[model samples]
Target chain A: MYQIQTPYLLFLGDAPDQLAAKTARGINDWRPEKVVGQMSLENCKADLGLPELGLQEAYDKGARTLVLGTANRGGVISAVWMDVLKEALHIGYDIANGLHNKVNDIVDVAGLATQLDKNIYDVRHPTEQFPIGTGEKRSGKRLLPVGTDCSCGKMYTSLALEKEMLSRGMNATFRATGQTGILVSGSGASIDAVVADFMAGAVETIAPANEDPNHWDIIEGQGSLAHPSYSGVTMALIHGGQPDAMVLCHEPTRSHMRGLPHQKVPAIKEVLSLATTLAQIVNNDAKFIGICVNTSQMVARDIEGYLKKLEDEHGLPACDPYSQGTAKIVDMVS
Target chain B: MYQIQTPYLLFLGDAPDQLAAKTARGINDWRPEKVVGQMSLENCKADLGLPELGLQEAYDKGARTLVLGTANRGGVISAVWMDVLKEALHIGYDIANGLHNKVNDIVDVAGLATQLDKNIYDVRHPTEQFPIGTGEKRSGKRLLPVGTDCSCGKMYTSLALEKEMLSRGMNATFRATGQTGILVSGSGASIDAVVADFMAGAVETIAPANEDPNHWDIIEGQGSLAHPSYSGVTMALIHGGQPDAMVLCHEPTRSHMRGLPHQKVPAIKEVLSLATTLAQIVNNDAKFIGICVNTSQMVARDIEGYLKKLEDEHGLPACDPYSQGTAKIVDMVS
Candidate 1:
């Protein structure tokens, strides 16, 4: 797992400010101190809760990396962005890109980086080959966040759990599977983009053979079992993650599934049963430890009531890991 | 849509005998009259309820087409089989191939067909392009049979329902989505083999412009919601089938999700809720009309007890669609 060697600057070029750049938003929320400050396009600038500066100035202010914070379509870097990168390279900062377009693929940038002796970390590409899963038992603890639906806060739940474990001085690593999570953690694949035939094999590459049985690999999950288009990636993760335990992530007040009004959200108990049965196929004892509710839509008063309701009904710990933290939920497995 | 223009000879060359030839088995069981005879290697020969004969001899016996009856891995054709096809072409048999290898792609065979005026129906390839799903409303009733696990008799349930509809003199057609169904119908894409992105689009093509308000489109389903490796294809089908009603299929005696012993089979009520919530996302009024159980594993007495218990529990209707027939189940939808 590659941790973002921080104090890095958040770059929001021409993107709408505040959570608009999902990659930057994730990094900002998860590790605020690693983000020393912010850089934004003049037209879309807003309060990033940090001082704004140019690439070179930000580097001088202890930003060691120039991370391409926007998820551009097809990862195509525009000519203007190329010039900004060249200038950043001159400022002696390393490059971190999580796009399909590799930084090393650009000849001019590669030549300059070779000249300057700075590394270009292309995070999406895997370093080692992994064979297809034999459903073999392996060492180490694996925790995966299964969700009720897409965008139900699986990533937030996973990151919170990882942070909770790390803060408690235990060894835990967040294994990213999506582009945003890959950018935040600096390793993993855009699993949904992989071909159906090799989806399971690709998942195996991210989960390494481990020596520490207590070491936790909290994997980020993709699409929902309820979602009609993207569930294949989700299944690969269940079989591939071989999670010893899982946390169910969901948004409480969302009446419809994300982007599909005709589809209703899956029942929480139903999704719990679904994920548990699916994961247990890979590991017989695999269990869903708790629930992570995305109560961002709920009002302050309703939040406590909803959490308690889920807890009382399911008889499992439930909380908005972002707002209430994952301490109690993490206790189930830790 | 493309029902096999029949009186074809079942060709099983150097392949395992019996229903082991999935495509052959489907055609033999569902539409047996179309298969005039069979061809087999020395090692694996079985009675096809018709006389076994050589290529020319079978054609002489009034067979117009030679349906490639085995789904080979990677769809590779051995040299001996190529020779057999060449000889079958010489004997004036139109070729119907469902393998990934297009009969038209084989140069000499395609040239021979052009000269002989014999058509090669590459059943797996789509004849026309289809756009991605818009979730648009269309006329007529579409009933898709969803299952608790793959090969949980989803195909059998769907075919039985369609047969019931047809016997009642209602306008109905069975939409094939897997390789066996494609061979049996001479239409439809093996959806799992389709690239993940266009799965829904492929489904849309099969279900085009339904004019009759009372017409029934009974589409065959693949995979299971409970299975981890193949749920994405299932979701694509859910959104793509856009069915107005659905039937849940289950193999009652099976202990776990197919090929996955670690995961137990889902409860019927849970699968009902899962499919209902999922299909309703496509068509809000979509209802679970019936349950189709595969009681092939059960003895005669146990079948009645199981069906009665389920009917008492759910209260809509339940039966072994193959044995008791889909009359009661189809009546619910009709």
Candidate 2:
């Protein structure tokens, strides 16, 4: 339910195309046919060679929806974009925004969208008021990706693990907690955007309450045990997901914490100790299964050596979750 | 700003005198003059040793306010209590509550309070929206008391540290984030009651921003790094407090995590590592200065030997913040 219907138009706005535009890039790569065209007010973002058009013109060309494709730092939509959003809604286009700022929180836009019968999908906010978590053990198999720092390949590791488990004919589903992951899976709450006290509760609701031994919930993690600003989200997931096992995700080439040059990634022993101790609070037997390396930053020649080095250091099978796949990691899960 | 003014009566309702009524106990202990009498429909909570009467009767005897002193589980007030609250307010009693349920959210009660000019202090909710934490280094020294789990002496350690520091002529303040603590200090938003995204921001504001080499902010910790239900609160505090030093608080005799018999307390070394690692996320130079033990459950004979053993094992000074003192801990802080 994260995405709007097909025949979608991408809106990058006046900003230059960058990593912040990752949502648009991911949608184009994953579901290109659904995308009708790219609309940009500034000169076309070079890499997205798709022809650009204004909102109304793009709508006439079979675009049924307008997706806010860029991810802003604070997750807020700029004021200048209000005109475009209102115009798009006036023309009967449903809008989808995957940011911390919900479109419905904007008074006028929500009113117009409701009046015009266009839906506003705020992918992050919880749809239901969840009861507080009980710390009660439930029956199920759950695997959560634990990373050394934010953006150190948690989503990549989780998706790979799900794909690997499915290839082996096991019943596994990915439970996402971030914008990109929710977009990829089509369902999942944005855990970081949730209210603080109910984070664990929101996490507990993403999957079935009853135990199903044959089913595996591969929960996607947000932030890290080492990410200062967002580790609260990580703690909530670790507790709420109550994973039977965890895959340690690490980016070998980064010397410091992501986006923070002054701070360093915790030593593997420390991160593992912290993650496991927190997880054990709910599930006493929860354990770390394997290491999923994000070695994409390394040259191909050095990637294998680094992964092997990790495997040797941690006494666990380690490989690039994306390039080498997560078969080795999945095999270690109970 | 958290407490109602002087001449307030405590409301325990049917709940018996217990540790859960710590808010009432704290008020009676810290500000006896402000507490006029105890109001309970059930048998009087003998522990309070105060006069008992109905709403109007208590109000007639210099009780100008009603203090919701019992910390209810899940922080929700029962519906039956509302009629009583409304009646108390109608009789000119200002209301003060330190719970997750905001008195202002109850439309009828709020409307009545406004009309009667009776103040309703919902102490747990943040007074204003807080900005995202910067993780930028700030002036003045901060010492945070981290615990093995919730109710494991974080408040006691912080208060003891502040008292000890003041005895030694250092300026120190106890920042409260819970009901009992707020009732004692007369300020501080409950970090747990805040929306998840603003927990850290709320912490940052609790301390002064300007550089004061001589002053210290003894920030109180909530929840635990190992508490499945409330670790998000712990993480937010660790990051938001940005403490230069932390004191590990533990109840040595407790074999299991608080209220969680299935989970064991983390080993001393593991707890220290986890705490230092999480704290280091916000301040690279952050370090654990000492250990503050909550030995209330310990037999007197075992206290000295246990403290010595902990000091030897952790390579830091250790003592019970209550029975002993935080002098050893305060000495280690800047």
Candidate 3:
């Protein structure tokens, strides 16, 4: 007889007790973990004991999946999952593990990073590759190789060269796995070196691939790269297909940065209009939705206040990172 | 001074003159193409005059982009675009390239395929490769290289591979153009040869990597391995993110196919219920919807009567491909 596997679900929240209760109700047959409540990335990492909480521990405890319910932090919610562990770790100021006795799946709620209208920083940085701890400049070439080690120490390489080609503006996108790699270049030194670097722990960065002024639109109260213009979102949606739910980010506009003048309010409003337009486009089925924005842009008193405003005004669930620990907790559990 | 570019749209119909005018009025400020009402894969080739429709023709005649609106024949409606006219001989299709004259620099339908839950087939056939059409078995190594000449004399190996993968139980639900190709192996030689035969022309096949069936759920009444399960409705939703309409194919159950002696109908209520469930799962949106069944599985007259009854009872658009010329047209075009 084939038994249906039960997937794990993770949820992050500011109040562990309330979140635990809500989660138990949502999934039936789940036991909620105790809340640690530290509430920040740094503090959460410390409380969770990052290095010690590695994959092995969760696997030993019989976890199969996880979910992160980021608390009502200022605006952002962070969540991550190690498919093998099936365990979720939530982050606030502190980290808490084992949200459920046995996690087999996840429900992600970390909102997207909204594009501010202007460039945040254009300072001339060095070209050298930066170390993990130091503030050194990381060379793009060194960081991205064909077969590099992942942070998890897994050796991986994409069979398709589309990523490399995209990096060189040769084409728009690329996706690859193992077998396809052999046919493309027939195991050459340069290809091997590229593959090694890729496996060595290359970072996947999503930046503006093209420069068309009209492509920029505003979300929340700042200017940003329009939803359609962003490569990561486009790629994810295209490859993953329609997700049951999506989290949108509405970070502060570039004009509102610390050094910029405050007269750009009207411009910021225009950007907000664009955000609403994007939300409308994606909100077709009313699937679970959430938004995130920096406090510096909208100046909300708390994360819940901001979320409430978004819900009332745009029929969206919005939050600010300053007061919401949602992203942190979500990240830990996920 | 930079002039804003307006998007182009294409419209096709049975009564080209009348439907074109109606479409123009419905869309507001749009032109229509008049051709014999034939919009199948094979007929599309003829209708578009693919051989003669060169890049210069596309650019000069302002037919680079198009929107097709054929009569909702046999429950299927399709729209595609001529995105990039690389040269007179080569062309590319993008979801964003609607029938409008103006083109948007940024693609609006980047991940549109995820929504429809469908499979995309390569333009060329598997037999296109063994041009002598001898169907003789040969050493797999003897086959042409990656970018070899296909029946169309085009290099679309990735596409051919995608088709073969689908046949071999790979759920290659959707695909689009990018810089590189995603390759798979580890199956066997015969399988590899079949895959190679499929991707003779296209550059890449965008679909989910063939996954272990143990990880997925198998829903029924779609199609057989020969035709495969390429749900048009699913494809539309996934490719466009938001779909304008959908068409579903509902095959009869095994009991119905055997034609055992029975008194009155065998309570087809279950079949109709299953079809509705499948349709809803494939396309959540309640928009234009249609259903089709293979003639071999059920008596066309009886099935038509039952479908009409269902349509009247449920207010759903239930149809079979018995009377319409759409399927015939598709055969002609392909």
Query: For each prediction, how big is the interface RMSD?
Result: 3.6, 1.9, 20.6
On residues B213-320, what C-alpha lDDT tens digit does candidate 2 reach at each position?
768898888888777777888888998898888989888888788777866677778778887877876787889899988878889898899889989988899998
Q: Give the TM-score of candidate 1.
A: 0.72
Looking at model 2, residue B155 earns an lDDT score of: 85
Candidate order (TM-score): 2, 1, 3
Q: What DockQ does predicted model 3 obtain?
A: 0.01
Q: Is candidate 1 or candidate 2 better by lDDT?
A: 2
Interface C-alpha RMSD, model 3: 20.6
Off by over 4 Å in 1: A1-20, A24-69, A73-140, A195-211, A225-245, A248-255, A262-320, B1-10, B28-67, B71-76, B82-139, B195-209, B235-248, B252-257, B261-320
Native contacts recovered by model 2: 0.59
RMSD of 1: 6.3
Leading candidate by lDDT: 2
Q: lDDT of each structure?
A: 0.77, 0.79, 0.24
* Candidates in descending lDDT order: 2, 1, 3
TM-score of chain B of 1: 0.90
| Clashing pairs for predicted structure model 2, backbone only | A139-A211, A195-B196, A196-B196
* lDDT tens digits, residue span A8-86, model 2: 7888775465676777777675457777788776543434666677788888888877877776534567776778899
Q: Name the 10 consecutive residues with the lowest summed lDDT in model 3 chain A.
A: A146-155
